[model samples]
Target chain A: MMRAFFRVAWIVVKKDLTIEVRSLEILSTTIFFAVTVVLMFSFGLVVDGRPLNDVAAAILWVAIAFSGTLALGRTFERERHNDTLRALLLAPADRPALYVGKLAGILLLLALVELVLVPLVGLLFAAPIFVHGFHLVALLAGGTIGFTAVGTLFAAMLVRARSRDVLLPIMLYPMTVPVMIAGVRGTAALFQPTPDLAVAQFWIGLLGFFDVVFVTLALWTFDPVMTD
Target chain B: MHSDFETLAVIDVARHYGRRKALSHVNFTCAAGDIIGLLGPNGAGKSTLLNILATLLAASRGRVEYGGRTAEQAGADIRGRIGMLGHDLFLYPELTARENLVFFAQLYGLSGAHARVQAALDRAGLGDRADDFMSGFSRGMRQRVALERALLHAPRLLLLDEPFTGLDQASTKALVDRLRECQQAGCIVVLATHDLDIVDGVLSRAVFLQNGRQVGEPGPGTALRERYRQAMTT
Candidate 1:
């Protein structure tokens, strides 16, 4: 069962990567959007030391989360527009396995985008995020897993809706507040090099829990949503 | 693949979408190795009945049984043994034909998935195009790929909705030939199609569904078509 899960997961990731390589549109556009958001933040914040350090994690994650949602929303939108997702639904696999495959695809893309954005944002804001390095990456991954799981489920619904581009963030943001809060709070802890790992671990664990809960819910619900 | 599916039965199944009744008290049976053709006009619930049997949709009322096992109780087991091909080709446009098949093979949890996909490709006459990108393929070529994907898991029952849609005369002949091979291999094939020309000899039995009801007993030959024509005209 475990082998089956990862095999399906890997195939979905490969399919998304194949498309990304050919088009080169969604990836570049997402990165450009992220850079533009970073530049806007720089212009608005004025680069003062204390205020910059305090909210830097919040700005970084929020920007990544919203932009990542756009990329994911477009994932199924592209498939549905071309009627590709419908074909997939006809395949003789367990529906929940397909849900896992889709979640992995979106999560993989979000992770790849964030790897580039993290340091660029740190440089833009003159914050010390990269100082802790690996720990910060783990925190980012934890938050992203939860976000992508929920985001993919909602995106499948919005794919067929007329106002999907506008509806995705509106539907996803309110539900992901807990994830956003935990992401920022955990990242902030990692950056500061505090003696207490408890608080950071607590937030990261909360994000992890959210990941598990939403992933289960999404698997249970994705078939009905995808069919619609 | 089961050689004996005489026990597969659909009992008084009905389905509704909001206020509109799609399928009403549908009763049908397919004995082992039977190639059943479900024929009806648009909104006649041919697709709805097949979708319910494929376990993709639930019947509002009634039951389906395969080998005396209720589809509801045997949902997972039944799904594992069945393959479905709907209107959408469903291939990832960017992935090579090989990638697409392997992806579905993994989903079906097939052992030696790579080899099964290769065999399915050969069955669909797509072996030469295994590495080609599906996005650039012709409509007939894409449908072939979809057929290969559907056949990859060696399903005992095949549910194809309008499988002849984008095919040329030659391609359609090839598909019929492949259907014959599947029938010989003991796979129960069920399809819903508007193309009566192809159904004349291809179906073991053709069922006429008019306004969501099966008009009479389905049987072989021109009688099924006559009943279908009369029911639809009336």
Candidate 2:
């Protein structure tokens, strides 16, 4: 059973990846949106000779959060377009496995977007994010897992809903508050002149906890919520 | 498990969508080699019933049993053995015909899935266009690929809702031929379609539904159009 679960999940991941690779729809749009957010913030807030370093972490997190939401909506919107979600549901694979598979795909795309966004934000805003690359990656991983875990669940739920475009963020943002907070604070701690490892670790741990809780909840509720 | 393994029973199945009764007290049984033609007008619960049977939607009141095991009991094993084709083509427009089949076959966990996918594409008469993206294919070609996808796993119980929606004349004849082959292989087939003329010769029995209720006892050889007209009016 475990082998089957992993195999099905891998197949789903491959399918999504192949589609995204061919179309470049989700990755391009998400990265563009994230870059725009970073540029808008940099232009709006950067004062005379004073970097927006204090709020750089907050800006990065907001960019990721909003762009991640966009990726989540698009990932599932593709499924809705051809009624492929229903096809996946009708397949014999485990429902939670499907959720995990989609989560992995979304996480991969968001990671790519972040990879580009982080450097752009650093170069544009003069924040030295590259100095704490390891810590930043950890924070990004933790927060993104939690964000996409819940985002994948809600996206699947609202795939067929009429108001899914507006409803996805409305339903997702509240649930992801912990993720955003942990991500922002962790990034902030890493950016400090004398970085507080303890503070960053604490927030990272909280993000990990959020991932565990929401991923488990999503696995349990996916079958019921996705079915009629 | 061979042909004898095919059996599907819907016992007192009722589905309600927030007090709107889509299906109420819907009951039917299908055995091996049974091609049951499900006839109903719009909003008569044909798709809803097929969805329930496909395990995509749970019944509000009753249960669907396959080969003496309810879906809840048989779980993924039973689901693995059932194939369904709904209104949607269920193919990714960006993927080629062969790629789509390979993806689904892998998901179904079929061993030698690549070979199976190729065979299915050939069987669907899409072997020549296997490399072309579905986005470029005509609606008839897409429907053919969808049929191949449904038959990929060689499911024991095949449920098709409006399987002939977008097919051209030749494609429609080809689909009817494939469905006949499925029936001959002893798969329990439930086809929900309004085109009684197309399916009349292929159906072993005809089941008429009206307003979520089974209206009449129509035998396999009964004239379906006459019976359907009578059921709809009276």
Model 1 achieves a DockQ score of 0.43
Model 2, range B1-234, lDDT digits (tens) per residue?
Answer: 421256788899999999899988878888988999889998899999988988889999988888787788777667778888879889999899999998989888888988898888888788889999999999888998998899899988889989888788999999999998998988889989999889877888878888988887644445778878877777
Worst 10 residues of 1 chain B by lDDT: B1-10
Q: What fraction of the native interface does candidate 1 get right in terms of contacts?
A: 0.45
Best by DockQ: 2
After TM-score superposition, the amount by which residue B160's alpha carbon in candidate 2 deviates from its true location, in angstroms, is 0.7
- Candidate 1 DockQ category? acceptable
Clashes of 1: 2
Stretches of candidate 2 off by over 4 Å are: B1-4, B218-222
lDDT of 1 at A166: 88
Tens digits of lDDT, candidate 2, A18-56: 999999999999999999999888888888745656688
Which residue pairs show backbone clashes in model 1? A87-B90, B6-B32
**Residue-level lDDT tens digits of model 1 in B112-167:** 98888888888777889899988889989888888877777767788898999979
